[model samples]
Target: MITRVRSELTRYLRTETVGGALLLIAAAVALIWVNSPWGASYQTMVDTSLAIPALHLDLTLADWTKDGLLAIFFFVAGLELKREFVVGELADPRRAALPIIAAVGGVVVPAAIALAVGHGAPGMDNGWAIPVATDIAFALAVLAMTGSRIPVSARVFLLSLAVVDDLLAIILIAVLFTASLSLLWLGAAVACCVAWGLAQKYRLHTPLFYIPVALICWYALHEAGIHPTLAGVALGLLTRVRKDPGERTAPATHLEHVVQPISAGFCVPLFALFASGVPLNTAVLGSLFTDRLALAIVLGLLLGKTIGIFGVSWLAIRLGVAKRPVGLEYRDMFALSVLGAIGFTVSLLVAELALADVGAETIELAKAAVLVTSMAASVLGSALLLRRGRVHQARRDADQLPQGEGSTK
Candidate 1:
């Protein structure tokens, strides 16, 4: 059972690794398209409207990417998180402590730095959450690319920390960003969630039965002005994580396996393509140096995330609340935390929400900052990992040898 779970996780990480590369390609395409002579066409494409007023669904393509497609990504995340809590590492208090602490530090410290740096600056304070997120796909991609010999334990830590960080981001989106609440729609969404849970409880595993309920939940949440992605998280959390010995897989695990590909391959890249096309006008470039928003965001992501996650994790270890995983070292933790600083997917969404009241130019500037900062983090993390990777590879080689094979030889 343990081997099977490990194999499944390895498969999932490989999928995400490939997806990260695709995400980069998609972002590059968007950049080129936006800067190309047909830049107007690129703008038109995202702004294009798709509305079903009868269903209270009136949204641009960009809106659908953020609120609709991104839900799949969150759903997979929710499933992974549920599995960890139910039957995975997080169920072990010792294993769970460090990542949980690191995740909290990663969120709070970056937010503090962002708030402090952007103090009294319009829209800067509001966008504090922008630096609080970690792009799991991109971070894992860099890890995969940079360190073939990296320990499985390190990967586990990354996923765990990311899961907690994502949960925090979800809470922020729900609480801090929500403008108004529609009680009727909110109640409807809750009812749909309850019905979905009951269906799962009764062994109604048919996609036909669950899909409609899920969509209704998503629609209701959207109408309530809450981020519709929460529907995925709610449904995912409701799904059963444990299976009978006679059963092949739990509903939650099965659902995650089915949807993860869709999330990694389709939803995320689509969102990146739409969300990452910031214009490079001279005015924006000139404003970048003058604005506090970009600097605060960049520093928060690049510096604050590393300090927060690594520092808190070290503290946890020192306090005996947690122990370092086998085969990982101090530098490895620092490098991993640096990789965690690459915030893009949720960060971009937050950027949009944060600057809603600001001008279009301000919003664009913020998005540009996210793109720049994510790249910088990626490069810095890869550099750190490149050195760390050699150390780990040598350790692995020594471990793989026969007894006394390489000792003093």
Candidate 2:
């Protein structure tokens, strides 16, 4: 089970490794389009509405990226989480405790920082959740660039932290960002989810059979005034993660293989393209430093994420609440914490929701801050990891030296 999980994760990391580069390209294109004289055309495309009158699915292209496409992304997340809990490393309580506890610290401290900064500016406090996200693909892509001297423990630690962090972000979205609920639609979503669960119990493996089930959940959640991407989470957890006795592969394992390409290659890059494209001008550029919202976002993602993630993780170890994985050092964990601060896609999503009522100007400033801070976080993390990787490599070479021959020099 562990080997299979590792294989799946390696494949995922590879996809994200490339997807991160593509995501950057897509975001750059969007930014250029929106800032060009044809910028109005980009806005028009995002605002343009598409509807399936029969299914009652009506949304702008931008909305589809969030509600429709991101659902697939979250579904993949759900599958991996369930797999981990069932048969992967997280099945062991001791193994799971470190990342989960540390993830809590990561979420809380960043929000506290954002809250502190935002409190002085009335109406800016609602965006506390904006800094609580980690852009998994982008962060992993940066890690992938660090080369082979990086420890396996570091990969596992970062992956574990990211999973738990994302889970917290999802809860924050559900609890704080959701406006009002329609019980009828919410109940309908539950019913569809229940039916999906039963299908899993029955080991129904066909996508044709379950795709409609997923759509019903998505549609219901949309009508319930909840984010429809959550429907993916629901269905993903319901999928079987273990093969039956004598059975070959888990349904979830198979589904992940099928869905990953679609989510990584198409969904996420498309979402980044639509969501990123904030028009930059003298006024917008100037507002980043002038506005409290921008300051909150910048500080929260930069200083807050590092402090929150590393402090909590270190405290957990010191308090004996969690044990460090072998080969992982405090500084290595700190490097991972810095990478955890790359709150790109999810951070932007939260900014949109957190600033939905604040005004267009506030939204744009928050978005710009998220973009700039994510890049800054990436650079900072890379510098640390690069230094560490070289030191690690040197130590490895010295260890390979025979009979301390190099010490004579």
What TM-score does candidate 1 reach?
0.93
Question: lDDT per residue, candidate 1, 1-409, as tens digits?
Answer: 9999967755663476788988898899999999999999999999999999888678999999999999988988888888998898898988998899999999999999989888888897578888999998888888888866777788899989999899999999999887899999999999998898898777787889899898989989988989899998888888889996788999987887778777887899999999999997887766666788887888889889999999999998989989897778999999999999899899999999888898888889998888988998999899988998888887867877865675757
Candidate number with greatest lDDT? 1
Evaluated at residue 52, the lDDT of candidate 1 is 90
Instruction: Please give each candidate's TM-score.
Output: 0.93, 0.93
- Report the Cα lDDT for residue 132, model 1: 95
lDDT of 1 at 255: 80
**Backbone clash count for every predicted candidate, in the order shown:** 0, 0
Model 2: per-residue Cα lDDT at residue 50: 94
Q: What do the candidate models score in CA lDDT, each in turn?
A: 0.88, 0.85
